[model samples]
Target: MSALIPALERQPDKPALCFGDVVLSYAQLAGAAYALAGKLAGRGRVAVWATPTPHTALAVVAGVLAGVPVVPLNPRSGARELAHVLADSTPDVVCVAPETELPEAAAGLTTLTVTLAPPADAAPLARPEPGPDASAALIVYTSGTTGAPKGVVLSRRAVAATLDDVAEAWQWTGDDVLVHALPLFHVHGLILGVLGPLRRGGTLRHLGRFSVDGVTRALTEQGGTLLFGVPTMYHRLAESAGEDAALARALGGARLLVSGSAALPVYDHERIRSATGARVIERYGMSETLMNTSTRPDGPYRPGTVGVPLPGVDVRLVDDDGERVEADDGETVGEIQVRGPNLFTEYLHRPDATNGAFAGGWFRTGDVATRDADGFYRIVGRKSTDLIKSGGYKIGAGEIENALLEFPGVREAAVTGAPDPDLGERVVAWIVPADDAAPPDEAALTDHVAAQLAPHKRPREVRFVTELPRNDMGKVMKRELR
Candidate 1:
C-alpha cells in the first residue's frame, strides 16, 4: 500500500504483473483490487490460497487496500500444516481463484473466489488509509523447524521500511523489470519479489516454474533488469552457463542478481562469475525479520559474506553467555542478534515463544555467524545444527561445506556433525557427486578440506548421495539429515 496509490495514478497503463500469458497493467490491477476491497471493506483477516498466479497477487493487493491482514497459505502444504495454519490464523474468509479446489483444511471457512479480470468501467475507489504502522499486514508462518509453524506478525511499517531500505541499497528504481520463479508463500517471493517491485512502481515478470530456459528467456527477452532467485536456481544457471551463451549473456546483462533464502556456496558464486561477469549477491533474513543484511551494490562484493546490514537495521553477534562478540577478526563465531524496525512484532498467539526469542532488546536469530572488521557478516551455521564442537575446538560447518564444494567431482555439499567417542562431535560431509561413475575418493575429499581449512576442521567422514534434501527456498534440510 506504500506506493500502490501513486503507481495507479502515475503509470496506470504500465505493465505491473506478468504471469504466463496473462498481463495486468497497473490500472487493471488497481481496478480489480479496488472492486475486491469495496466488497471486503469490513472483513477481518483473510487467507489467500497462495499460487504463482495473477489471482493470488490480486487477492493480496485487495487485502492490503482494505487494510486487512492477509495470511498466505502455501498451495503445496500438507494437510496437517494447512490445518495448523488455518486454525491458528482463523481467518474470516479464504480467497482463491475460480474452480480452484480448496484443501480439506479450509473446508469450514467462508470462501471467496478472486476474479482475475476487472470490469472495464470499474472506477478506482478512494484509497483507504492503512490503519497504523503497528497494525499487522501479514501473518507469515515459519518453517516449523522447532515445532508447529508459528505465525510471525509483520506490520505494515515493517514491510514498507524493509522494502524502502532494500530499494536504496540495491539502487532499485521504476525502470527495472524484476524476474523470478520463487514460491509466493515466503517472504522472499511475495514480499520482496512481488511487493518490492510494486513499491518501486516497477514491473515484475514471474516465471510459473523455475528453469534455466525460463530465466534465460525472461532476462534476454523481457527486458528484465533485476533478477531474484535462490541458490538452487542460480546453481542450475551456473551449471549450464558455460555451454549456454544465451543464458550467460542474459545473466551478464542483468543489472543485479540476488541470491537469498539460503547461502550461495562460494563455488557456485565463482562459477557464475566466471561464466557471466556478474556477481550474484547473498542476503540474510528470516520470517521473523523480513531482511537483515544484504550485499550492497556500491560496496565491496564478497563471495561468501552476506554483506552489511541494511539502512535502518542493526545487527550484532553475541556469545552464549549473552556477552557481545568483541572480536571482529572473522573467525570467532557467535549467535546473531538483531534489532530494527524491519522485525516482526510477535509470534501470533504465542507470547511465550515471542518473549523467549528476544534477549534484552535484540531478537536472537539462532543463526551463528562471524563478523569482520569491515562489518561484513559470514554465517557459520545454525546454533543447533551447524556448529560442530570437535576436539574442544568450535568449528563452523559452512567453511567446510564450501571447501567440499570446491572439489571437481562434488556437485553439492552439506556439512554437519556426528557423535564420536573421542572428539565429542565429528565433522561429517554429505556430498552429491557431479559424476556418480567417478566420484571423488573420501580420502581425497578429506585432504582437500584439511588443506583448505585447519586440519581439525576437516570432515571425519564423507557420505555420498544422489541429492541433498532441500526446502522450497533451497535451504538444505539439515534437520532431516540429522
Candidate 2:
C-alpha cells in the first residue's frame, strides 16, 4: 500500500486513466482508493461487480491494501453462476455497479454502491504492513466446463512473484501506458493487465467491454504504448484494419502487443504483422499459473513457438511413462510440466484434483509440447483434448489443424474425434471459410488433406461453420464440439 501511494504521489499530475471524456490523475486515484479502504475497513471479504472503470480499479486496490480479500465478480455471468460464486466465496460485503440491484445473498451483508465520481476531501489511509504469507487476493472461479466454480487462494508472495516476472520480462516502466481489454475477473486481466502495470507505476486504460471500433479508437486516440489481448481480438483488429492505411498507421504507435489465453495461429500472427507492422508476441500461460513463458522482445521471435521459459521458471517434458525426455530429440512429445514461484498454491477445496496435478513437486500442466534443438517450445495440443485415436493410429489434432491452416483458402480449422464403431473414433474437421469464398466440399477437402497428411491423419468428414464457439477469452471450446 505504501509503495503504491508513494508511486502515485510521485506522478500526481500524470494521467492515470481515460475512458471517453473522463480522466483521473494519479493523486485522484490514490485518494479515491484510500477513501474506499476506509469504508471497507472492517470487511473481511468483499465482492465487487462493476465495469473495468477507474472506480473499479480504485476499489480493488483499496480492498487489498485494507487487508481484505476482493473477489471480482464477472458482470456477464448468469444468475446461477453468480449465486454459485457468492455461495462459495461467502464475501462479507457486496459492491454493486451503479443502478444495479444487489444479489439475494447481500440481504444481511453490507452493500456498497460504486460510482465514477471522485470523493471529496478524502485522505489517504494508513498503509498496512502485511506479512509475506498474507492472503492478499482471491479469484473464486475455475475454467472447468462440467462443475461449479472453485475458489483459488493466492498469497501476496505468489501474486507479487508473477507480476515481478512479467514486469521484468516485458520491460515495463512508469512511462508505459497499458491498454487493457480483458475481463478483470480472469487472471490474465487482473494479474497481467492491471496489477503488473500498477506495480511498476505504469498507467492502465481499462475498456469495460471489448469492441473493434472502441479498441481502434483507443489505440488511435489514446496513444496507448502497450496492448494485451486474446487471439480473437487480434483477428478482429486485423480484419478491421485491412485496406485502411490510416487505421494501420494509427496502430503503428503501439510498442508491444501480446496475445495469450489460447494458442495463436501463426497465420493470424503474420496477418497482424503485415497489416499493422507490429509483431504480435505469443505466449503460453493458464489460469492456474499466471504466466509461464513468452517470446522475448529483442530476441528471435519464432512464429509458431511460445519461446523459452521466463526468468525464475523451469520447464520439462515428461513422457507418458513419467520420465524426463532429452531435449536433443525433437520427436519426443510429452506433458509440459512447470515449476516456478508463479504457480498456483493449489485448487481450493479440491484436494484430489490438486494431488493429481502435482507429481513429485512440479505442477503437471495438461498441455503437451515438444522442445526444439534451440530450446524453443511448440505446444502441439492438449493431452486430453487434442489426442485422437482412430483406426489403430494415434493422431494429434493440432498437427492436422495446422496442416489444414496451411491451405490457401482455409481460414481456421478445428479437428475432433467422433464416435465410430469400426475405428473406435473417426476424424472430423470443422472449418471457417475465407471472405466471400465457399467452403471446400468434403471430397475436395479430403483430397487436399490426403495430399499433405498420411492416410490415417486425413479428416473423414468436413463441416463448415461461420465461427467457432469460444469462451470470453476467445479459446475455442472443443468439448462443445464433442
Candidate 3:
C-alpha cells in the first residue's frame, strides 16, 4: 500500500487511466480507492460484478488496501453461478455500480453502491494490517470448459511474485502505456493487463469491450507501448487488412508483444511478424500458477515452444509411470509439473481437489510437454481426455489441428481419437469451412495431410462440423467432440 501511494503522489497530475470518455489521474484514482475503502470497513470479502471499466479497477485497489479479500465476478455470469460463488465466499459486503442488481441471497449482506461521482463526507475506513498468511484475493471460478468451475485462492505474496516477474520481464516503466482489452475477471487481464503496469507507475488504457477498430485507434492514437492478448485476438487482427497496417505501425514502437491462454499457431506467429515486423513472444502459464515461462526478449524466438522456465521456476516432466524424463533430447513426453513461488496455495473450499492437484509440494499442471536440446519447452497437449492417441501412437490434437489450419479453405479443425476395433483407435478430423463452399473432399484432405504427416498420423475419417464448442475464454472443448 505504501509503495503504490508514493508512486501516485509523485504522478498526481499525470493520467493514470483512460476508459471510454472518462479519464482518471493517479491522485483521483487513489482518492476514490481510499473513499471506497471507507465504505468497505468491516467487510470480510467484497464481490465486484461491474464491467471491465476503470471503475472496476478502482474497486479492486480499494478492496486490497482495505485488507478485505476481493472477488471479481464475471459480468456475463448467470444468476446461479453468481449465487454459488457468493454463497461460498460469504462476503460481508457486495459493491456494484449504480443500477446493478445483486443476488437475492445478498439482501442480508451490507451493500455499498458506487457511482461516477465521489461520495460525500465518506469517513475513511480503518485499514487492517494483514498477516503474512492471510488470503488477499480470490479468483472466482475457472472457465470450467470440462466441468464445474472452482475458485482458486491466492495470497498477497503469490500475486506480488507474478507482478514482479512480469514487470521485470517486460521492461515496464513510467513511460509505458498499456492497451488493455482483455476481460478483467481473468488472470491474464487482471494481473498482467492491469496490476502489472500499475506497479511500475505506467498508464493503462482500458476498453469496456473489445473491437478491432477501437483497438487499432487506441494503439495509433494513445501511443500504446505494450499489448497483451490471447491467440484468438491476434488471429482476428491478422484477418483485417486495414487494421493490419495500423496495428503494425502502432506496435512498431512496442518493446514486447505477448500471447498466451492457449497455444499460438505457427502460422499466426509468422503472419504477425510479416505484418508488424515484431515477433510475438509466446508464454506458458495457467490459473493455478500465474506465469511460469516466457520467450525472452534477448533470446532466440522459437515458434512452437513456450520457451524456458522463468527465473526461480522449476519444471520437470514425468511419464505416466511416475518416472522423470530427461528433456535434453526432446524425444521424451510426459506430464509437466512445476514448483514456483507464484503457484496458488489451494482451491477455495475444495480440499480434495487441492490435494489431488499437488504432489510433494509441486503443482501437477496436467499438461503434456517435452523440452528441446537447448531447454526450450513445447506443450504437446493436455493430459486429460483431450489428447488423441491413434494406432498405438500418442498425438497432440492441437498439433495436427494447427497444421490443418494452414490449408487455404480450412478455417479451423479439431482432431479426436475414435474407437476402432482393428487399430484400437483411429484419428478423426472435424473441420469448419472457411466460406459457404462445401468443405474439401475427404480424399483431398487426406492427400493434403499426407504431404505433411506420416501415414500413421493422418486422419482416417474427416467430418465437417458447423462450429466448435468453446468456453467463455474461447478454448475449444475436445471432451465434447469425443
Query: Would you list the rank order by TM-score, best first?
Result: 1, 3, 2
- lDDT (Cα, tens digit) per residue for candidate 1, span 1-482: 33433565478889999998899999899888888877776777899999898888888888877878899999988999999999899999988888988877778789899996887766655655575473688899998887899999998888888998898889999999999999998899999988899888999999989989999999988889999999888889999999999999999999999999888889899989999999998889999989999998778989999999999999999988999998999999999999998999999999999999999989999999999999999999889999999999999999998899888889999999999999999999999998999889999899988898889998989898899998777899998888
10 residues in a row with least lDDT, candidate 1: 1-10
Alpha-carbon error at 357 in model 3, in Å? 0.8
lDDT of 3 by residue, 94-181 (tens): 6777777666645566767755454555433455545535666655567775566788877766777777776666666889888868
Query: Model 2: per-residue lDDT, tens digit, 150-263?
Result: 776666666777777777777878888888688877788877777677777878887767777666667777767888998788777777777767657756668788888877
Q: Which stretches of candidate 1 lie over 4 Å from their true place?
A: 1-5, 124-127, 132-134
Off by over 4 Å in 3: 3-6, 102-110, 116-132, 241-244
Best by TM-score: 1
Off by over 4 Å in 2: 1-6, 102-109, 116-121, 328-330, 391-394, 408-411, 421-424, 435-437, 450-455
TM-score of 2: 0.91
* TM agreement with the true structure for every prediction: 0.98, 0.91, 0.93
Residue 59 in model 1: lDDT: 89
